[model samples]
Target: MENKKEINRRKFIKVLGAGATVSTAALYGCAPGNHSSSTDNPALGEVPIDKMTYRVNPTTGDRVSILGYGCMRWPLQAAPDGKGEVIDQDAVNELVDYAIAHGVNYFDTSPVYVQGFSERATGIALKRHPRDKFFIATKMSNFQNYTRENSIEMYRQSFKDLQVDYLDYYLLHSVGGGSGIKTFHERYIDNGVLDFLLKEREAGRIRNLGWSFHGAVDVFDYLLALDVKWDFVQIQLNYVDWKHASGNNVNADYLYGELAKRDIPAVIMEPLLGGRLSRLNDHLVGRLKQRRPENSVASWAFRFAGSYPGVLTVLSGMTYMEHLQDNIRTYSPLQPLTDEEKDFLEETAQLMLKYPTIPCNDCKYCMPCPYGLDIPAILLHYNRCVNEGNVPKSRQDENYQRARRAFLVGYDRSVPRLRQASHCTGCNQCNPHCPQGIDIPKDLHRIDQFVEQLKQDTL
Candidate 1:
């Protein structure tokens, strides 16, 4: 006898596989039985599915969907054996079908995404459709094994796993982040991997070649300065990173500007700053909502990313049907931001810097903590409290008593006592895994001290 929660989880997975419109409508609070039309709910009026905006790759003449699908965060459910987690393949297939029918033609995945199963799952889903209908983008992702043989083997494995004869787009995964310029050179330049990839492109096995950047401006400049013509480049671009990049000194504005100057098509990632831009403070939310009352907060980020002339595509990791629908509507007929609107968002970014919130995207890459701390939940609760005005600055503030009570109550309710931040031992094992470059141990320690002070009412 399964519990109600377990039964509902299974039911949801089934619903996702049955049909796209029905599943998405049900997920968004519409009646499940009435699968006739989406217009039943005024909220989901009618997405211009056939009117999706597109941009062309100047080098290859590929008309890519501006809203490219990122296959990193697929929906997950407990395996039938109830032993471990597994991607819900049926749901993935339905989502892929729905996306393609609605005008999306690009999908991005990597060897290491989704516990190393993303590429295979993506291939399985996309293979059911016409091969010429959608473009496949994947990466070498051999960040560790720099040996030429290992690199070549990894590259070949991607094609086999993807079930594709030739990749439409390929990237050097996470360039410039870990070991800086020297490691980058040792991985690609010294090892002859770059030369091999260039040859693959020349041979038509790889249609386009580029790299996804993370840190170290010198490395970015170094790659761009090469004689090799890069067909496209991916960078983290959002209103927040445009001006206030968290850990990296380089900003998206500079990155985009550099690419634009070089006539290189820029592929945008982290347009929502790993969901931070979507979940904004009440004050900022009010500011945005007041203008576009019908739009979601996430749509603003998408529009901003698409406004650039150099952008070839903006990648979003949509795990749920509702996310897919919302993004589809946003990009169907993208409303480019006006200069005034851009200024307003820039001002909002400046104001957001005043409050210190950890830039954790809840990606869950760093999980199963050795110390049993729920890192994402801790950071989420803290950020939520900050957004809702439940974080009191001092004990003397007028709302300190109420805010303190709310924060403490919410923190405990959100995260179990055994998995709270106070249990962190500063192991620092999670630091290297975070894509956002967050200082995990330092943040956990600081948060633990803050929680202790809240308990003692000393701060």
Candidate 2:
């Protein structure tokens, strides 16, 4: 019988070997289900003087920068003609250039970001550089249009839009049961989507196949079991989410362990818990400051996720230069969080669960609200207002107005005016769909009333 050490050695060898012909089952180690600094991965590259740390994929021996550039929220400016259409080309190009110059190379985007323009914008910006300069990751998001034909066409269109023949990394978008995963396979896999993708892979159009998960651990495993040979999996992993009431994204410990067992790598998302961790409460901030006075609160969260062994990269949706710079500094030469610091963060995580705030991570899952509710966006604005100490009448009025405009304007433009929040009619269809269990009709009515009052005041 092979001993534990020999078994692990063999697994590591297979990990660096050519794809899929090996026993993926041998990839898991016998150590406790947690992270450990093992052998020095020779293929791993160090972040430049400008960067901090580097993470390696156990399977492919690829060294991805610890901080990945997430193009989901690119900076926007008004068009040259100032027609109110925001021009993002220059900002996107600069950000992409800065990231690459700093030795950061993993770029993640999706077809649905920025009203379906993020992919095009990212493709154009990155195309300015050599293809080998970065790994392009995007998703097949055809859930709302759930048909097999729609899914395949969307995948084909993604390649055309990104100006790349093959995706370095491709995900099945979100991994929930309802409209997310169910619709994904219905439109993709069950409809022979995997067969088509495999043919593309054989032709080298897809370098890696992966999925980003949301609800249902079983569904995540089920997707992995499908013989499709997933190269990696992305999960919403952060110190706060480990024990989040929504689901222990802390379950990520198990999820990552399982993936490692399967020789699959993990890409982490929501490291700042959709920016909440960046705007922590004063007491928690003080505690973190006392421990590491120089690091941003967001840095602690990002490090906590990167401290793990199997994570291939951490994604941050940086919307501004300062945000990008701060993240670059954090990952440039990261100091792993101490055990006491991890405990403190876990304590902070528990404290975080005390608030009445909704658990929307801005994953855009609750989007396309049938009632024209800009659900995640509105909730995020509200949460940001409250977190930033601008919730009082003296400070919150302007922010409140902005939120009102965003919701009312988005409702008018995206959702039909008649189907606006004012017309919710208390049907309760959206209540159960909300992962956060928030009373949808109740909040919509409150927002409608507030917007009406704001309009009256402006009048």
Candidate 3:
């Protein structure tokens, strides 16, 4: 396996070492241009500065761009000391420059994204531009140590890092994770942090206050029933997850319906289903291509999310110029999906349910595995092979040699040796953080066993 072929097996997967979204473009099998430097990629020029769709917030009357920027997966590079990774500030500036120029004004970040580097980098990039050029959003990500002091500190620090006097949008970040309502109360209500945020909103410091939901429907309804008037709410909405929500997540149809019922503007997330929809199986890809030959498979999801009148903006965590360019093209003067097209995507979603891919969104909430395993990379690589039809079942399979080598070699190439699935220690620290409610340890163990089996069958 120590050959040139093995080393370069996944050369096209990683972009600027953004383990976050590197494989997002793997289906195209084309290595991206240098997005690390300030150098321009002509594709960036194609992003329309005027054609972007805009939606109004009924409460504030703020006209937000429909194509919002999710700052969770910023471009990354190896740090100077080579000990760990760091956000690529120059790349972020370029990405921000093109996004603002292309009429993208809604930028969302969180205290938890990019290992707490997202807000700082986003602030640095946007600082050069006029403050009115963008509407910045961040979260009260008091997932742990949600004591009143800690949670309040986390909230205040966001202002400092974002370099903003007032946050345009502030969230109660990814509620309903552990113990559902119990966790919600402890994280926000019991600690008085929710009251503090609500007060800030009244003082004009937080223009819009909302929460991003990721768990039980009861919690979603519970939050909606609260006396507080939510300005906007974020939920994972894509064609596949609209009706057939997996894991602890609520279906997008229900989530959106409830938000619309309350007349609340919605901020959409996970339009790509963690890149699974884009890297669909060959037959599915062909089906989509047959319908819209010029459109990217990923565009269908964006169209689905943006088609709804209730959606204020659809967020895409773009890490490269091409991803940004492709999204801008899709949303430029937005084309709402017709009834027939919506039905087609629903059928496509039903077909996608059959594939056995793990639902890791690469949110990296379950990151910094104590034992050094790269959880998202391991799961995503497995997902890619599954989509590509490269995960062979047994040695007797006709494509055994090709598939086996593809799995083994691609796994090694995409994930560093120390960070491979074999390193997972089943410590279970990553379980509660997973918004999809994946049994991280069990899945890692199963994947490790599969890899070991593949290695032993040398035939």
Candidate 4:
């Protein structure tokens, strides 16, 4: 009979199918469980400028930083007119300046991020630095308008918005979504967009070309099986998703294995599972704290992604000064995970799986809902209540009254009355854009119904 370690490893292999690449003893480290006990957080300290870890791009030999800056959630401020919000230029510049000063050189952005202002905000911030000092990566992001003309114009607009003559890295953003191959072909091949991009690569306008995956395993396999020489690819990776992926996502073990086998460098996204890992429950936080009290809850996830030799970079959307500082400290000479530590994280993932939480990364892809419902805020609040154990099952439970009060109070504080889940009209407009494959209208309605039940005094 096998020991617990061997048994767990075999079980993981059987479930994931391509278990050769992932291991209970090795993958990314992430805290799992509740966040209320996450108070034992590591203190921030000095980040070394010359100590940043670098990865070599085999195709172009570009030396990219192990920690890449993801420009998806830039800091925002109320617009002068107070009608809405806009990216905070000063805040962005400070973050960029500090990141570069600490040796981070790779910055990734797309046309769809930050309500279509990410490219412009990122451009404004990065323009302060010398061209040779950093690498710029952006995407076509033409999900709605995939016509050849519209796609090419979208691609060109990136150059104008970013104020760059050429892009260091370019991608067919959010591929492999929904209809899988059909959507991929219609978005790139059928519209001649891929052909145009290849020609752009030939003209030296795009230094490296790749795509991000978010759907079926067949779609990923089909893309890799193609004749095109992919420079690098981005995928959602973290401890939880390594073998036990939620929703419609494929396991990361298979995704990473295929890329490693082809020697295709991988750019990791959602390393924290949309910030799920960092904000683990109290019990889970205690487990990680017992082993390494000095490391932040978020560091485990970052080290896991950077530990893989085949990974070119790990992206983090740093919106605050402390987050940027903490991430820099984690990657400024990364300390790879040990076999024991990796096994511990695998166990954490299993325990976390037992607790059902919605897979919302707060990427804000489902923003500006036609019905005025705040999608991410609602889902994130629901997940937080789940992690904190505030969602009551029955009025007869011991703490039912307390739990109900907390949920209702927190819900109102976290989301406005008019923009709460109750406001979701089930328009289905925000469904396709979600990378996590969440059933937006369905989940929203479910949450709304739950709130209504909680309001009732009936047992």
Give the winner by lDDT. Answer: 3
lDDT of 1 by residue, 1-459 (tens): 235533543453343321211112112111112222221111254767699999989998999999999998887766676645578899999999999999999999998676567899999999999899999999988755688998999899999889999999999988886778888888898999999999999999999999998877998999999899999999999998998887743799999999999999999999987676776776787787898878787888889999998999999998878778888998888889999989988998998888788887665556546666768778867776676677888977888987887777777766678878888988786776576788888888887888888899744
For candidate 1, which ten residues in a row score worst on lDDT?
21-30
lDDT of 3: 0.83
Candidate 2, residues 87-118, lDDT tens digits: the string is 36888899888889987899999877765678
The true-structure Cα RMSD of candidate 3 reads 7.0
- Tens-digit lDDT track for model 3 on 162-261? 9999999999999989999999999999888889988999999999999999999889889999999999999999998999888898889999998899
- lDDT per residue for candidate 4 within 116-161, as digits (tens), equals 6789989998999999889999998876666899898989999999
TM-score of model 3 vs. true structure: 0.91
RMSD of each: 7.9, 14.7, 7.0, 11.3
Return the TM-score for each candidate structure. Answer: 0.86, 0.76, 0.91, 0.90
In terms of lDDT, model 1 sits at 0.80
Candidate 4 TM-score, true structure as reference = 0.90
Any runs in candidate 4 off by more than 4 Å, and if so which?
1-42
By TM-score, the better pick of 3 and 4 is: 3
Clashes of each: 0, 6, 0, 7
Task: Give the candidate number with the greatest TM-score.
Answer: 3
Please give the lDDT score for candidate 2: 0.66
